[model samples]
Target chain A: MDTASVTEQPVLAVIPDDGVRIVTVGLAVAIGVAYGILHWLNKRSSEESRVGAIIRHHWQPGAWILGILLVTLALPKYFTIVAITALSLLCFREFSRTTGVFREKTICAVATLGILLLNFAAIDNYSRLFFAGGALTVALLTVCTIPFDKPKGYIQRTALGTMGFLLFGYSLGYVSLLCNTPHSRLLILFLLVAVTLNDMLVFLFSAVGPKSWLLPHTSLGRTRIGALGALVVTTVLTCFSGMVLFDGTPLAALVPLLILGVGISVLGQLGDLLVAAIKRDVGIPETRPNSPNRGGLLERFDSLILVAPAYVHFLSLMLGPIGSDLPQRVITGGGP
Target chain B: MNDWDMQPAKDLHLTGIERSRSYVREAGLSESLIRWCWLCGLRNWFCRWNGLKIEGLENLPSEPPYVLIANHASHLDALVMASIVPRQHRDRMFALAAADVFFENPLTAAFAASVVNALPVWRKGNQQVGLKQMRERLQDEKSIYILFPEGARTRDGNLLPFKPGIGMLLAETGTPILPCYLNGTFESLPAHQKFPSRHPITVTVGQSIDSKQFQNRKAGWVELANTLKETIQEMSGKPAPEGLG
Candidate 1:
């Protein structure tokens, strides 16, 4: 008998699969189908009616839905940061372009570059100190808006400047928090999916429901039916997504998240309305002579700014701190 | 060419100077190049420099066979007009220039040819040749003729009497005329200064007037000329000339 035991086979360990890969693929397909259907419906609706006329009459609720969908689809993680940051810059640039805020409106171009740097800071979870600095810079800008003689103009500029900072700086800071969280990539995806669903539902509701003026004075005026529909849809989607992604979360924990989603959606709509009101008050035409129609940047991103801080606050409350080891179920209202 | 022009119409069997078609062709080429350059460089600069207060630019036509009649106060008036007219229509436009001034120097003459597309006119002498050339240019469907009907810069920076030549050209062509009022050019580059000073200028374009309305009226060339002067004066918020009713 050979001492080497040539017939003996080496033992190999069997790897058990967690089934995450399958679920991710399924989620992707579902999102793709939903987007395709929505796109087709939007196209069909536009063909049936004049888009401009429809928008002028009832745009707010639809805009809110569209904005939420865009934010949700973006995910706001490291990979999606570039896209989100680009949008943030565009929104701010458009706001400045339309409002004619800076003395040399060209300065907005440079400020957009600075925003990219801010986005980087946000992603690394480097320091809250940088965000604090940004807040201080905004305050200084507001002070600079003070007029030598006209107090009214001073106050107006200060308000406008402060709003710009809140929208561009503070709101955008949440994206950094998203990047820094443990399993941030997964959480961002969940948020994006939930928000997108919320946006779509809101849009559908607004389109079909009875028209009632939510804000009669502002350009982003919405109907009571539209608002109610948005809240219902957002809550349902948030709760549903929370259940599906997180296995151990309690129903009681989810109520706050649902409320937060509804509140953010409503506030976002109000921000859009505020921007439109500003343009209307200023009497700046949506289009300039020999130029294409660009309704101004501030008008475009009004809602995003309003919702960003609230989103950040909600995340902080749920997750404790951005870089902590809190499980997804706990952070997203899925766990007890 | 000079010898050929000296021969009498009877001997040559010619009917007047074969109305130099070359002048129109030359005008077209010169206007195009100058207009292109000005559009590329000077327009944006002028807009920035003056803060470009344009009141009624939309009223002007995109294509032109119309007369652009404006108040002339300084040499800078032409520059301002060139800078202000929409870039699209610049190439087809011509400004009437005094032969004694712009055409005298080689550099000035070349500039006048390329950029201004200047139609040189003798202010005093025989009006027949100048008037004939102007009328022919205006008659063309492709050309836009600009004339400072006051004939010369105003001494007091107020508009002078309307020259009869403008009325004669208008009567012959029956083209719509656009009245333009230029303010602050005199301060920017006053009549007496050689170098232009930095001053903001405003170029206001008034509504276009149809020549058909005045076509058959008893208001002969002189009366028509006075009417034009009055129209421009009213648009500019200045008083009409003293003696004209």
Candidate 2:
């Protein structure tokens, strides 16, 4: 419980160098093959090319894959935290713009400031403050309108602000929390690769496998076979990755790894569907033109948003707290 | 069932420079924050630099769902008019700026839209579509539009005859039109000048004019245009020149 003892414990000692190397090399090869295939397909096809259409549709995902890998490999934990915070801010912006929630300047301003504060708490490694920030933000948002006396859209603005803060601020803040943990690179890299692979595998299976719809209303392209196929593939992938990433931990066991694997994939898929449902409900074809092909930050990383918290908490529950033996509240000195 | 109705922003899909100049451009959190900063800067600049003074501030409508028309002479005219809007209605305010000028390029369009919250008003080629969108937005969104009925800034300081397009927006609609005449703006930053001089600028806001009785026709449009022009002229406290009548 003492901060001094925790600080002296070697957190990085748990990281297996071979596991990191395998994951990094595996990611590089996977991304390289995707780009190479895309290049070949684009060149091989004619004007009316199906591959061309597919390329046009998924260029953003390709870029995203490359970007995530680069960031994970090249950047430190601090930069990764900054990147996630940026992503959360962008997602919130897209959400606010699409939902017309941002029209409430006061609410939007407060939520933005609140999001920054949440990220600050995460960076500070103050879990207590990070957990407390959400409630404080919601309360602030609720009363932020009372002084304006513009009761007309008060409920709408407050609701939008709360939802935005919870989804983007608190939920996305989990990534930053994970970044602050011991062997964080391995854990975070696993999360990123697993989520991205889950999406790609689901799409591939849906395109090539049996054609029964998964959910006709939410995801038209997704099929039952594809969904289950992705589940199986993702579970296996997550299990392997977790085994390497977790190494000597209790999560490295077969049953626990399977549970983590299945949980990550299921939660990731649900997150994607949730965003799709939101877009449909709001009657927007896309959230924002994030790239030439797909929607904005949320669309690209929607799978990760829910998965971050679920995987993190699950890992913490099975194992002890994230970075338990590592330094506690590195910035805040573990005080009131 | 949930009674809380949620609507998405209109300009969600637009990207890059297009988002800035889009008629459907909706301000999100970052844009709103920047706009607040811009408003603060604009107010400070106007008061300290232009010696800005606004008359009949009480004549300004408390909420939106209305249009504010003014005499255009300088680039500063729009800024002067936009700066006078109260805090409650600041974010909702959209200044109708010429697309040919303000929205000709990405940078200027970004400045106009992000800083000024101005929606592009294309001067040529089937303007009705844009006006139709504006009209719909003005009514449905309960938004405020700061427009110059003259369509373009005058070469001289003289007020040009109001364009028919203003009538097109107001015809058959009960949307109130608040007429305001801007003085010393032309002297501050005329169309010919790039940088503004430290000339005093004054905005005189008159009573709001309702166009309920007017039909949405050419004849009705002419009447509405003339009425707005006369109100602006009177607000200017100037004798009508021989030919403008």
Candidate 3:
């Protein structure tokens, strides 16, 4: 692929304008089927057990997520980017609140501002500025909090702030950047549906498989077989979906599709584990605030945090640099 | 190097409305920012609207592990108490608000938790358990609590008898208690008034009482409450009513 060709203007459009309609419908159907199965199992299962009863209530949030996904598909590109930015900030708020980093008001303010700027760069289609966010965030988090003159928890707070910046600000902000791509709407839908399915499959597989722990300490209930099960299931599901979603592109080919699917599954699980690891380090391994072992937005979207960047990079490599054809510097109105 | 012992927020397990109405809800950076801004505006509001004046700020403790108790006459009393402290200590200041009144709904709960940084104290729930959590949070997090020991706003503009709940929080701890009286706030926004009317307000803060001086029991707490109530009544420049104590 000629990476330079990505800058060329007005390439004949291939994908239909309403191309995501079928994929969105497919995703809704998939969620419906899963919900039906869960409802069926919940009916048969005894609610005397705590797990059985709580898992029965899973459809509440499942319906909520489906509603959000459907609404996002209907919105404009900028709306999706703004929603993603808001998600990143809310997820960061959860992390900071959970890890005791919220105590440092200054560090949190800088991290929040950094997250907003990253998304702003993505909105502007200024990839260079978006790429520069990681360094800038760490630098600011380290330097800006020095005036407090209370160095007691300096290292801890700084480290927490940096990690939060990297995870929510830089990493998760990629979802906003992905919106700058030609295949943004369908692509986001594809990733969201796939990841949600992957999580459900992982949980389902763990309940029945050889009772084993993925990392006994980090996640109290995650099974090794469940992780492997999600990897295999998500790979196949995402690969088939990618064929339809990426029809006009080379990514529709079996080999590239398979690679894309595997990348997403592996990276998604790793992201989930990364969040699990943080909670473990902070002595709050698993919190069932609403659902069993499912926590706030951070826990729910942890997988998406990593998969977004990886998918963007994969698309950039397969098809030229992602979002290159889009108007450059929408905010600054300058060329690279 | 400091030992790596990272204690999460006390209410880490709670989320959303549950966290907001939680008695142990700890305000985060966002809430702190909102609270700071709210208090700053409130300071200006008190001064300009009510022509607010202060008598003894020098009597407040330099650090936390202290409680501020004042006669509750109107809704303005809590805001007045919270805004009196310096900006540096604003983050640690939390006012104990009546759960039914302030945290009954989402909009009011958000305001109570974020802007006011007030924790819900259920008047009819398990008082001992709630007070234990509040007391522990005060000491562990180095917090300053603004409490209205009168239990509820006075409807008739007469001071209510101090409840022993305040002593339950300070018992066995050396946390100093600052007795204060807010003159003219009842007239500004009395229990009957839906909205505050303009009235000059003057707050007189007495020196802290070593809570350790009182016994850590019901009788001792009652005695402590009466003593502080007497101090505040004296600050009101009212003659001690006979047989009230």
Candidate 4:
């Protein structure tokens, strides 16, 4: 497709009656039903079936997958950005708690302001402000602590605050950026599926494959065979999904899409491992016990953390500026 | 290079409500904001409704890692004590509230923990653990605890014999105990009254008692309690009321 056609395309034009989203929702519901039935059967047959444990553990993640699909389909493009920003804050709340940085009032205040500003930039479609937020927050945090003059945990608090902003505010802000693009729905659905599938495939392989260790210290559940299986399976799924999502763009070419897919799969797993490291370091079983069935919001969104930034940059590189054709600074008084 | 000693929040794994009520609860932005709003509203209510006049505000140490002990007569005692906490240290002030009364149910617990920034002192069970936890916090975390050594609210409008728990917390810690006396609190809102009357109340702040001189033992706790009671009695100009230890 030509550049003009790409820019002129309606947001839903590529979705084709929401075929991709429908399939995703259908697949999720089917899996959920199947698992629910199995869990019921096992409960009836035995008092303590290991299947019950598996179902309990996986239930929250399963619900989140279905929930995101439905929400993406229902919410307007702007609301989707808002929703993502809210999710970023929730995740950051858990991050602050686990990192003990919540104790630092100034750091927490600065980070929260940073998150709000980043979201504002996303909503305003002001890329300049969005890019400036991280540096500005770092500067604010550095200066914010100096007023207290405690100087005991000065460096620690500042660094923690900055990392919190980058991960939740700066990194997740890219999702809002991507969602504002012309074909955002398709792109977002593709992202959700790729990351979710990557994690699910890894679990499937690890659960059934040879009981050998991978990064036992980081994640005891993962095995070498499982890692290899996830890597290959994720690559294939990403390539296929990319083929559909990026059909008209230069990414439609096999090599670029393949690289993108593989990159997402690898990055997704790495993100999970990174969170695991945090849990282990913090000496906590889970990030937060906010939900009975699910781990913290961060746990559910862990894979997406790394995938979001990478996906936005890569797609932007392959296709020109995301949402560039959309009227820029819709709220901040600027033109496309 | 100095090692980066940063750790996750002590209550990191706790949910919102639970973290608010946690002994190790650390106030970040949200909690700090909530506490600030509560304090502002409480301050106004105290001043306008009860005619609260806080005296000896200058007596408070400019920082935390200290204890504030006052005579327990009504529920307003803790609130009155917490009101005098300097704005800078307000977020760090953990009011030691009665677990059964304030934290018996989830709703009250959420209110106490979130709005009041309270940590439950279970009057019935496992108090040693709670006192020990508070002691550790005072020493290590630089926490400021607003407590009543009288243990429970007075049945009559008179002072109760001070408990040794305060001494246990401060013994050998060298932590200063800021002895405050709240006058007319019982008249404003007695233990039995669900709603407070518009009776005037006064909070008089006195010099901090150094608990370091006392031994971390029973005899020391007795002496510490007696000294605190005497100081409060002297400030309030009321003889010690008869009560149990």
Candidate 5:
């Protein structure tokens, strides 16, 4: 609960850092069980069984993505920053491609540079630079196309560029900053597992209640059971995981832990709905429906988009400012 | 004010070689960067090493949705025109390249698609389908196409007959076509020679011809192609031989 204690990290904290060892072990075991279930589901998934059909359709790709996250987390801390940077880039790429904003190379390049600088700022523990990145990027995006002198489609392109940078570049930048914290490796794993479980649990528990649509317009699949499942599963997972991840902090308290769990699940669902709304608005079909192909990376991590920022803020609220204890601006070299 | 104004890139669903060879491919920032840098370096090389010179630059259109039709005798022709493209129009310029040659493999396909910003015209496939798609892209994207209406590169130092492919792209369209004559490219990089040799090349861009005057019919396309071919011949200061149309 004290700022000093939050900053105090053991010098020898290596990859699969003390607390993350548990998460890694859980993921390693889950990988095998997931594949086993997928193999079984593939053989027996008929139209007759709705549960089996749903599991068969999504579990393989979901497990594969989680497996990749596990591998990425088990690497050195610097690699976590690299992975986050790549995630931001890919997300921007998909967003730009989907919205026809990629044609505005000036805006896209500024956004791309902003995303890189965000990760750089986070890596150097330069909170000032990191915090300034979003506004600076939006400013650049606004003025980037002025030289072209063509005012037609100006509003559409600038708005798209601003939104894309804020979501994929700026918001996702928080994940890396979270990794720069004292117990970053564990935090990353905890957030990843919690959000993944929330999404998964919601779907799995949807078979329980009389399936009625929660937001029929935004999404056809989000049901009352799914919403309740998200609330309960994410809350419990957060409360349990917070015990270890926030071992010495106020976040480990019963009320705060439960709140963190609920916040994460709620934000996670909102993130998912945001992407669904984007796809619908952009007029792209839900391509994975009735198709055997794996879902796009955009679809897989859609929930993490919003949850990442909220989780980081939750940590900051409870454990003091992340990266505040470390020497700041290691790259730019000013702040202490 | 347009409804659903945020349409995705035309090539969003395509991947790998399919994306590279597809007619609907749109150049992204990566491709634009590659083509811009590619053209910049090539411009220097052609200007310095090949002694390239240009005239009648005034005839070049202020914007795109225009065609740059030139004689094809060497690989240097496309490379030269590609290098000479204005910086503002770099990403918008696409050359109609031979699918059998440039798009034969991944490496070449990438070069043709990104560096050259080319659209593959399969010599054997449905010409109408590809032409229709390219025309739509040219209009929708406001593209500038570098076309060699001679169809294929000539082996000897003589110009080939004008083909109807150019007509297919321009027929009934309001887009303007600029007839350009490129001299000494055949000597620099002839059909038999894979690499270009040092040679002074003079490029002459003539006045733009509005294709709105031509009908969208087959006969109109042929007449338009002939008119542009003759314009280039006159610019080249060489009359077509009795046999060559």
Candidate 6:
């Protein structure tokens, strides 16, 4: 396969008169305006409120802007890869900032940049060996180079860095690689839609559901009713979206997709908890004070880091090799 | 010291004597009831204040007689751990507190006995008696013992050297040690702070490591202590104790 020809060719056609195109453009503009207005209001409100002053003192606006840019640009296939790269960098930054034990920032930066390059190479249809080898080398080098001064700090930095590589680099790289596969762009978009809907439903459940003081020690602040609400909403939305977007998907595939949605939602919650766990360990409440970002890098990209890997691995199994005729068979249940 | 001798003072025609005696009794009761209530209250308040997060509660065994060993970063560690344990099991658990500190005053002693259900273990002298008492508590089929193997609050919120008492306790009791790691407690209430600041605290309980795993080891007690500290460090995502190096 000539990878250069594929990268050079434009994948999406512009539909100037299409209703979907109009709707997309209109929605984007409206969201942009709303965000601008919210930002202004937040600034004014912060100036007026004492509580907001304390918050603003600790907030990192730059990280928030970068995070928003990544999420917004991720809608386009090409930009999605860039967004993933940015996410990886931000996550690495967040991990390093909160963890005082990581003394080798230069090494961490090099390893993180290598992972991003590997991700881009994977997306551009470069040799899988290159991606795999680079990932392995980075992992090995990080583990070996960590100082032996603080045994706990050494192990923690290594473990966290390795986790970031696997989660942000390899898993996200596979998601980008999907864009090159036939009908895989639609699959990537479908995954995002399902995930967004899942997040929305979970947030709604947490906001409106009955509150329980039980397990008040947890950071989730979620009640049993809220969890049930999230589960039901995620399942229904996944199945409905599958029916609409992937009509040819077999019942077998649909079942797994439903399971995947629920699992991702749970893992997303776990991801949130994991980030909180780190903050708790470091005695830092949030990374906003140090990073100029309100939610911090870990807080913003945590769910994506966790879900991206699981989604890609599951997608690979569901849709065999990139050009294989197995996707159709699997969708139609022709054979194992 | 005698109940009958105290009754005459209670019966004396002192205008607020009854109310004062009742207040004393209530204060004593408050230690046990107030301790649990305070724990629950603090958990809720801090969860709201700093947005606390907890995970891996499922990893904790429902059965009893397990030794809960955790890193001691602050004085709040015991309260935080007790708050997370299922309410059903809280009554059966006893926290091992420094005997000199908790038993220094009569009121504190009563409160410790009633609310905390604290087992007063000597920090320095009389190791034999303290060990015997701890073993006796562990030998009971229904009792749970919570110990901070670090011996005291860490000066810098880092895991300090593990006291040999834990190794000795494990050797004698041979119970499953549930290694717990508490995060953010130092900032919430550091070593010198008398009151906890509004900071979120998280307590992670790792899988239980059986005491029998280290039984009869030829190596020194530091080896077992290192293993236990490493277990907690892994759970907390912190560096292991420096002494292991």
lDDT of each: 0.57, 0.77, 0.79, 0.76, 0.79, 0.57
Which residue pairs collide, candidate 4? Answer: A98-B8, A99-B8, A100-B8, A100-B9
Candidate 2 off by > 4 Å: A1-12, A31-69, A104-107, A139-160, A284-294, A323-336, B1-4
Relative to the unseen true structure, what is the Cα RMSD of model 3? 2.9
Instruction: Identify the leading candidate in terms of TM-score.
Output: 3
Model 5 misplaced stretches (Cα beyond 4 Å): A3-18, A27-39, A46-72, A143-155, A207-210, A288-295, B1-4, B239-242
- Highest DockQ: which candidate? 3
| Colliding residue pairs in candidate 1 | A72-A192, A94-A297, A95-A297, A95-A298, A122-A176, A249-A334, A249-A335
The CAPRI quality class of candidate 6 comes to incorrect
Model 4 chain A: lowest-lDDT 10 consecutive positions: A286-295
Q: How well docked is model 4, in DockQ terms? A: 0.47
TM-score of each: 0.45, 0.88, 0.91, 0.87, 0.89, 0.43
In terms of lDDT, which candidate is stronger, 5 or 6?
A: 5
lDDT tens digits by residue: candidate 5, A1-336: 454654575321322355556754564354345445445554565654555544543454445545665677768767888888887888888889888999888888999999998999888988878888878888988998999997778899999999988898888899889877656776787777777777766665565567797887776556888888779866875676566655654655899988888888898888888987887787665544354433456677778889898888877786677777666777788666
Shift of residue B178 alpha carbon in model 1, Å? 26
Q: How do the residues B115-231 of candidate 3 rate in per-residue lDDT, one tens digit apiece? A: 888888899868888788888888887889999998898886667888888888887688888999889988999877899999999998899899888888998888888888888
Please identify which of the two predictions, 2 or 5, would achieve the higher DockQ against the true structure.
5
**Predicted structure 3: lDDT:** 0.79
List the pairs of residues colliding in candidate 5: none
Model 4 RMSD in angstroms: 3.8
Candidate 3's DockQ: 0.57
Instruction: Calculate DockQ per candidate and list them.
Output: 0.02, 0.45, 0.57, 0.47, 0.49, 0.01
- Model 1's CAPRI class is incorrect
In candidate 6, what are the lDDT values of residues B38-150, reduced to their tens digit?
A: 66786687678757777778877777878788889887788777767676566567778877787666677666666666767677776766665566657653567888988
> Candidate 4, fnat value?
0.64
Per-model i-RMS = 29.9, 3.4, 2.3, 3.0, 2.7, 28.6
Candidate 1 lDDT, B22-70, residue by residue in tens: 1443322223545678655766766777655667888777767887788
Place model 3 in a CAPRI quality band.
medium
Which regions of candidate 1 are displaced past 4 Å? A1-83, A104-117, A145-152, A216-222, A249-252, A283-303, A324-336, B1-245
Tens digits of per-residue lDDT for model 5, B1-245: 54546578877776667789988887777778877888899899999988899998888888887988999988888888877778998878899999999999999998788778889888887888888899998898889999999889887666788888888888878998999999989998887877888889989989999998988888998999899989988888976778877
